[model samples]
Target chain A: MIEWSHWLPILAMLPLVGGALTPLLFRHRPAAACFWAVSVASVTSVVAIALLLRLVDSGGFSYAVGGWLPQYGIELRMDEVGAFAVPASLLVLLSLVFSRHYVARAVDASRVSFYYALVLINLGGLNGFLVTGDLFNLFVFMEIFSVSAYALVATAREPIASLAALKYLLLGAASSLLVLFSVGVVFAMTGTLNLEDAAAALALSSPMPAGLALAGLATGFAVKAALFPVHFWLPDAHAAAPAPVSAVLSALVVKAGIVGVLRTLELFGGAESLLQPLLHLVVWLGALGALGGALMALVQRDIKLMLAYSTVANIGYIFIGLGLATASAVSGAMVHAVNHAVIKSALFLAAGAMIHRTGLRNIDDLRGLGRRMPVTAFGMAFTLIALSGAPPMAGFTGKWQIALGALQAGHPSLVAVLVIAGIVVLAFGIRVINALYFRPPARVAVASATEAPASMWLPVLMLTIASLALGLAGTPMLEFVGPAAQSIYGTLP
Target chain B: MNRRRAGRILTAVLIAALAVPLMYGMVQLPAPGHADAPAHTNVSAGYIERGAELGGSENLVTGVLLNFRALDTFGEVLVIFTAWLAVAAVAGTASNAERDPVPPSPVVDYVIRLLGPFIAIFALFVIVNGHVLPGGGFQGGVLLGAMLILLSLVMDAETVARAVSARSWIWLRATGVLVFAMVAVMGLPLAGYLFGLPDEPGLRQVLTVALELGIGIGGGAVLAGLFFAIAGADRS
Candidate 1:
């Protein structure tokens, strides 16, 4: 009876069942754990694609659990934006595929199954969050993924990893509580947890309670997304986490917060008094984050940490687009979210491969690797160019769209912040390119390093190619997400 | 005033000043128990009026928790399970059979021995009656977990270890989410949609009870496992 249209929820749950089985199946055969995890995520990706196509064909759909009508029962809703789950799951799959050799080397052998299990669980939580329409359901899904992320970040077994994970755990848990508090407030105001119902109810009600609830939800998501002034914990946590885990964290987990913000905008779009002010705040904070994060990235010598800070900056770019609250701007933000997920994961995996080959984290230590690890070097270099908002890569399309959006919205000053931030990011990226391709080896390990195995580099290369393909053929993505932008802000550019 | 004192006072005043609007908003909220309150006039009224037929549980709370907002409950179950996995991943799985057993305390041991069976049965009763009564899976599971911890507290570690192997503990702790997910998906065919219960009142009742038991058992096992692991009771 489900046919193909109702497949969105299944795409989320399949990885969950696989997560439940992975540990038990690989109790003695730990190697199979990675394979099991990839197979599950791959299956979820395929189904996600099928679901995406079906939803596009049929337009959009919603499934109310237990056949109970909305405003009463939980709903699983999918529109163009929710289809972001497709890219999220595919990126996670690629990360897991890259994780096999990396985890075997980076993590303790005995704990490999547990690591893979957490990865699958994180994937499930993310996918579920993407499609859920209930506020409390979102909180619950957020917790599911955040808890696993806290754990997986520490799986690296380094002392710093543990400390950073603990910090992340405390902050993340506090933010989730804030999110829950906001959900409670919204429920109290509207008496319905379904987002569309609540939004309609909020539109009819006074602005005060909705405003407070908005404050709570904004702070919570801002913390989750690592927005400026609240991103204090990201660099350490992302840098200290295992490379594969870093890829997942930087690429998808951070985007979860921005996704939450967009959903909130869509839900509250009709409440102009509330949304207008919040969107203004989002714009300023995003501008600050873009500048601050890039400056911070500019000072970091560790390539992973630099990537981590750059993630904070890239997040700023997406937020600025989203906060612009215009059709083209939000579309750019959405497109950027997808592009960053691809390019950043490629960056992390490629950087992870270098570290795996040479055990060096500092950019200077990894100098001359372009000659040694040719494919990985190419991946790292190309991702850098793409990420710095240069031409010929997918990253430029989103930034351009956002800048163009600023022009459309009559806020040309924000374009200044975008350009300045881009230059900072570009400068940092160029330094790394210089080190990787131009500078002489700084250590013996760098001079003697060999190329990473195909299991490791293959996914990185695929992602790099994906980064190019998505950039060059970005019109389809923009068109696909156009309706989502229109849903929040009525007209399109 | 000194600069530091001035700064501190200024900061406090600013914070309080900022909070005035929020406090003013709260003061304007509808009085508790008002008939026209949003909480009563909106969706809660529908749940109370029709949750039984719509959600298939006598207890409206359970109806909401299990059927109306089943995905939320599903997510809740995943949260707990993920917590256990996170802790276990950071701290490896325990092997109590190899550990040095703590000596049993005589009087406390006798007390737990007498109370353990009754507590176990009571937990089961709570879970089964959850649809009609106040107690449910989470409460029953905590009680069950408390019983095991109490047993571990008063008696030898070996007894608990013999009763539940480390491997069994992992599966039992995981059973909650695994079962919940399986049932949610199974709803597609068994009923009509994901997490949809059969419209038949009888079948819905059966599945809810099954879900309750799964949650109870899984929660209890995880609580015990998490505690015992943290207490160093199961460390090899």
Candidate 2:
């Protein structure tokens, strides 16, 4: 049997090829674009899973493009962290699968094929971003996805959609520039762009430039990850987007920032003093983010806006795990990244299905949708619990580890913030749940609304079940990430 | 200010507070580009020592881009291509119905008509000579793209449309990525690396030129496609 992952380059390239061929394949057959895009994403996801499995079994491997030596070339290195491509690709796959019917109603008919094309390109960009080990290449892939995301956000037919995308473009572009500036700093300091070499080299150098580089990298990724205080653009951008677009943005795209932060942490493994203060900064920022995001989320009337703010809070959770900077904490961050990608996408897709059916955006208008749309309502409920960190779900697994790690790292205070954020999340979850199940229907349209098509509801159900499965079988997942986490934290250079 | 505005002001203040540590960190960095800097030591020394021999290009930048660090260039190529996709999606007005281009001022049209051929030749030269010279895929691609827009400016849309119809234009626009991907696949069978060019000098030359031509042609067409899309001249 062929070693499937040896074709990793092709696996990432496959989507770009599909994206390039989409307009050709579906020029007149616009309806087939969705199917084509879905097929491409599925293949990419399969390969990503295969690669992750390989990494889990044999540890990860590196591929040098053009066969150049590490000192002179770009390296695509996949470890436990890089296995993020699996969830990222799978989430993109689900979103596109959900978009088949959703896109017909949500977007202009003429641009349907183009929409799928953008999705494929975005998928390609994301996979490439996760796998590449070179810093500048990472920035390059960041732009690829960011540019596609900006357009996708504006793909919806509204003035505000374009306006929101423009604001996103401005802010996102600024983040990208900051990332590039840091890349330049590293390149100037180390004469190399490869992450491992740059890190090893910087370990021997003065701390001043290294600190500057770290600061730049952190600030840039903070914006991308939507950390507290810098999260102003997220609500408008996420809410205004077409739902599938928002799902992926909320789910996988922001994870890119966390991935970047982790990579930088790993790269500068020997710089303990630098990482110490950075982690301290991260812990406090994450605390504020969690508290602030939940507080803001509680007041939102629009369901999607509430979900977006909740994402900010969850990002805060992940950053807390990361900022604790213990092996367990980093592991928790990784697990949460995976869990949130699944839960949040499921929630967004469910929300999208409901919105598609009844066209209600506000939580109040969606009252009693549980009776009308049983499957989506239940899916949303499971996702809400997952989001709020309830026990016996993926959410609790990550939160438990992170809280334990916070104590391990001697930060008892973050655990308090964790509790507070979780409670607030519970309050909002109850609000949405009450609207879905407990309350009487205020709108006749919502009262009579039927379930979305199988194509739509099936993905929501599948993702929800996947999250539950991940939680129940959470031990094995943690075991798999165990080596990867230990490798990152244990052998810090 | 009202409550919302006050809250916004508070958040802005907090954001600034967070950025202060970062500014302090920047201030602490050594000034960039000193010969004694950490970056000038490790991998930089090695690349400078043998990049040409290893990468088989006379020009070090081209060698690094085409052979050593080709993946980054590939990602950059994809980034620009994605940007074109985004631009087309947002503002693309190109319909299938080809419309006549309004005539431009004689001076402008005549100048472009006269210089377009030379510019095209120069772009080809830049791409072809990239292995031995400064300009490679991106520079040549940009030059060629600029030339295409210039040609379109002087000649009517209908004239260009007839030469490369909307249907054929799709393939043309994808030529860069397709050719790049194809060559990448071919590398697997040829040199046992996905983006590897052959180690043989002649083969390296051939592969580098082929990549240059592919990127140049593809990038130029995509740029022109963006122009048409934004100008609303594209039709399915």
Candidate 3:
């Protein structure tokens, strides 16, 4: 008689439920809609914290909706793996509360309301995807987030936004089709779409069907995760989207695919042996992406574009961690995912504020703006330090763990790659920082420079604080993230 | 003037050059597989047998809709709801305009008035016989919404707005899902999953009907809402 099971799922739905109701209740008052969105997200943040506490104390719980239970109906399973996602998703939504004013100034009125709705839906979808125990049900929520994301980008109404949306749409559709094809193959072989059931079936089956399914599923996730060659749509989409959308997309949405792949790996137990060569390929591709994305970012003039390319570099780091495929590496990857989201969101929002307040899109135009907007400049600086793996910051913690994990796995080359990429990151970050704080500002921006509204600064500030907190509280955070990795790697004992 | 002509010629030549490879690639690749596999068990045969056992109706599609894939249908209804809200936000029907554009022309209005009754009749038929028929909430809802979009095109946005606002549509959609989820939940302590009530045919039949009707109303309103929003934008 676990009471928490029922209540947790309900709590997850509160933001979604509020989002669904907001348009109706605040039909004529768009401002009220925004306020209500914040309230719902804030309430959800509290609930998520409570759930995190419960999970830490008692471990995790699973509840079957409608009481049909697994093998017959959908189930929401919350293990340590799922628990990690809850707080991350809550953190992303809470940041949106701060990103609202930036969005309001950047996007049109209709698009603003729609963007809030989509963000709420995205939060629900991401959380639902993590908690779900059923494979096909995961696909359903993935589609929900994908569709919302495509629409959200297009809402920018810039020509570049449309082009980016189109590219993302095509790539997303192709990736989804690949995923569906894998599900079909797996279901055909096992006669079940439930994760546990599929695992049970896989344990008894021949290698062929399992191999085919793994190949299809990995390809799908690789495309979504923006690994290597499939990374094309990412730079454009992130660069072209409004700052808040870019933040959410880079920090959270892309990680959904990473979560999918990790879940697949954990479920199918030597699902790896079937694709061992592919995993090696993933290592090299990730290394290449990391090096290439950083080099490209170094040459970019547009501040947002540089951050967008840097995200590709960050994603590559995540991939390298995953490809190591050991307990330590996987834990490193998960922690990095959380760390990257916090820092990346902060950076993007700060960049957006800089652009909005001064009407300057290029780094060269943002010269000596620290005097004009010290707070935004500081926020950007903090995120930059974290992104560059500075001491006592979230980014440093993730990189330290990953480097140790790489060394442990005997892949010392990856350490070199990480170091080189870190240098590239540092160089570009200093470039932006110098442009903002040291270089002489262009007369135009010097005249117009002012701070963005509190709505915008708040999210950016919270994210930067989170990045610092991650560094300072690395131990406790590692306690939770470590077990989550152990769960996925099947090395809990 | 000559430069413009030269530019047009250059563009045309580039297009032709691009189209050659595009056409060649389109023909050479293996076609996409969109068809359902035929190797599976004849689902219809099992469906027919079960349909008969459960006081089945003639519509096999409807039976499957209200039975096998009811949850997917529930989500489908939500997609429509999302579209409706999206449209309302775009239209701004409540402010700035007191009246809708003029009603449809004589011929279009005549056709709608003639078809409206029959359309209403068909919707009810689909909703009531969902457990026995091929058309369920989604298909029937689309049909209903299509008629409304058509009506608005011939009539005006104000007429449709007067009939229903964006606010009402969201309420209707939420109510539908809540009812469905509740019914599903209520059955949990007794029946199991939302629609997984029992093998005892009668209760399943009743639950199915109730769920479908709710979906139908929701589906219809969502369609109208979206159509109204798109049309309303064009009007302004």
Q: Which stretches of candidate 3 lie over 4 Å from their true place?
A: A487-493, B1-76, B83-113, B132-134, B150-162, B169-210, B224-236
How do all models score by TM-score?
0.95, 0.93, 0.84
**Candidate 3 residue lDDT tens string, A1-493:** 5356665555445555566666557655667767877787777667667777778888877776555445544667776667655555656665576656666666666546666776676676666667778777677667766766676666664668878988998999889887887776666655566787777666665666566667667878787778878999998898888787788788878888888887777657545465466667777888899899999999999988898888888888888887777677777788888888889889988888887787677888888888888888899987997898887998877777778878988899999999999999999999988987888878686656777777777777888888899888877777777777766644322
lDDT of 3: 0.70
The order by descending DockQ is 1, 2, 3
Alpha-carbon error at A380 in model 2, in Å? 0.8
DockQ of each: 0.64, 0.59, 0.15
Q: What digit string (tens of lDDT, one per residue) describes model 1 on residues B1-236?
A: 69999999999999898579667666666554888878788888898898777777888888889887888888788778878777777763434345445656687778889999999999999998999998888889989998998887776544674587777877898888877887787788887778888887788788899999989999998888777766556432
- Select the stronger candidate by lDDT from 1 and 2: 1
> Per-residue alpha-carbon lDDT of model 2 for A1-493, expressed as tens digits?
5445456676668887788778767866656998899889999988898888788778778887777766677888777777888888888999998998888888877777778888888888888888888888889888878888898998877678888899899989998888898898788777788888887877776787688788888888888889887888888899888899999999988888888888788777777777788888898888888899999999999999999999999999999988887778778888988998899999899999999999899999999999999999999998898888887887888888899999998888888999989999989999999999999999988978999999899999999999888888777877777766766643432
Best-fitting candidate, scored by DockQ = 1
RMSD of 3: 6.1
User: Which docking band does candidate 1 fall into?
Assistant: medium
- Please give the C-alpha DockQ score of model 3: 0.15
Error of 1 at A88 (Å): 0.5
Q: Output the worst ten-in-a-row residue range by lDDT, candidate 2 chain B.
A: B92-101
